[model samples]
Target: MTNAEANSGKKAVIFNVQRYSTEDGPGVRTTVFFKGCPLSCLWCSNPESQQAKPQMMYFSKTCVQCYACVKACPNGANKIKDDGSVWVDRSVCTNCGVCVKVCLADARSMSGKKMTVDEVFDIIQKDSLYYINSGGGVTLGGGECTTEPEFVGELLDRCYDRAIHTCIDTCGYTPWSVLEKILPKVELVLFDIKHMDTEKHKELTGVGNELILENAVKIKQMGTRMIIRLPLIPGYNDDENNIKVMGWFMESWGMDRIDILPYHRLGENKYDALGMNYSLGDLPNLAKDSISRAVKILGSYGLEVHVM
Candidate 1:
């Protein structure tokens, strides 16, 4: 939706509106989660936010097998064929969001919502006092805010006009032009650094880190406040060499603050709900000691580190 429309109460695609979140960004903040992401991080916590389009999600465990979705589907998307099993005909389904409303067990749900900018602003403004008190304001998180550059820029610009402290939690996978357009409007950026190894980066997130790394340097040069977030995945980029390389890179780039996010199984259920397999199922969370070790390694380079 256009900014005018968004401001005028026209709908824009958003997945979730999280409040009182501490980990996303500074403060007792409200996080506006936009739908759609460019990169597919295997350890993505919000699998529901990946797709740009609205889609139906199923919680098999919560389902009573009452065939409510089957009966409620207008396009016969939920049905049993000759195989004697229910199937969701994704192609025919318009995601009209009907079956989700009728589901009694909360097994059927829709991921994205179309909200206006004015609507979103109202939500964010509600916690303005809390933000002022807690050093937190509004945080824009998503599949990738840069993927919807126009919308993101306008949102930030509006927030800037209101003197709201805005932070963008991004994967840095967008074009430089897009980043350039939105970066000026934001106060702080929570840039995610997934992997240091280019090949391993591609293997995990479907793209290399070249552009991401490059953009980070450019962003640093532009003097935007930034904090680097590293997701420590076991058997992946958790090696000492990898951590050292990442530490060196951050040091060279003059990034002082780093947040090491330990991998967790919290999102495992989301993958299943989205009808996707969890790739990191067998992988265990990095031990607290390991996180401490990584912190020490980065600290040795004189970097301020926070392990979450």
Candidate 2:
């Protein structure tokens, strides 16, 4: 089959298409958040990203008490409790997204939708001028973007044709074959290192780090530029050992730049909105000195670290 026939027509459930994002990669970027991730991290900020299917997200604060959803929901899933709190009756709500359309206050929304390569590319290319001026381009992120390899690869292929810089913010948990197909079109790989020890990694992220580490090596072998991203969860992986080990791993790979993504409670409310239990809900906000401390430790190890 031709490249067009091979990768086209496949649809992936994407949760968000953030425009003018400076954090996903260098310069300006359009971050595509694909839904569905194989690994479940204890402190995942994007709980809505975990599921591949379309899901509902309710913002109770945004509700104007219009009760439009109450009239539109075919399943009677929208209701006002005795205390006057309007919310989706998630128990009976099928997440068909029917009520989201009728939500007058923009309080109700769906997190995922099926999109072909062309649809997503349309959004990406609209920012082409920004990409050209800022050395920025597209970054395919997740839930776990690689879960839909064919679709993502095709998107990258299209970006390549347009001369757009392409990258992926990946957990590195998927198979090498999955990444192998897409890496060719990827200019940078933002590889995340949740924890160094395999058992500890599994304990924190619901998956071992073997595949992730191996994928790092494979990507390096392919000569793809990479920026190692480490989320510094204060009480979790901020220990000296984990930091040193991560630094050493980078040192081993002859890598220099590592981005430390500080932990935050931003996604905590998102969990409640999605009717999911956030395991780290009780964890305090990351200490003010956490990132600085990590930078000191990694810098001492001769690894360049920057806080994102």
Indicate which candidate wins on lDDT: 2
Give the C-alpha miss distance for residue 75 in model 2, angstroms: 2.6
Backbone clash count, each prediction separately: 1, 0
**Model 1 segments beyond 4 Å from truth?**
1-11, 79-94
- Span of 10 residues, lowest total lDDT, candidate 2: 1-10
Please write out the lDDT profile of model 1 over residues 1-308, one tens digit for every residue.
43433453445589988989898888788899989988888888888888888878877778777787898888987877685546676678888889889888898788998877777887888888898899998899987767777667667767777778999999988788888888888899999999988999999999999999999999999999999999998878888998999899999989999999998888789887777779888887687778888999999888999987
Deviating ranges (above 4 Å) for candidate 2: 1-7
- In Å, residue 283's CA in model 2 sits off its true spot by 2.0
**Model 1 RMSD, rounded to 1 decimal:** 2.8
* Local distance difference test values of all predictions, in order: 0.85, 0.89
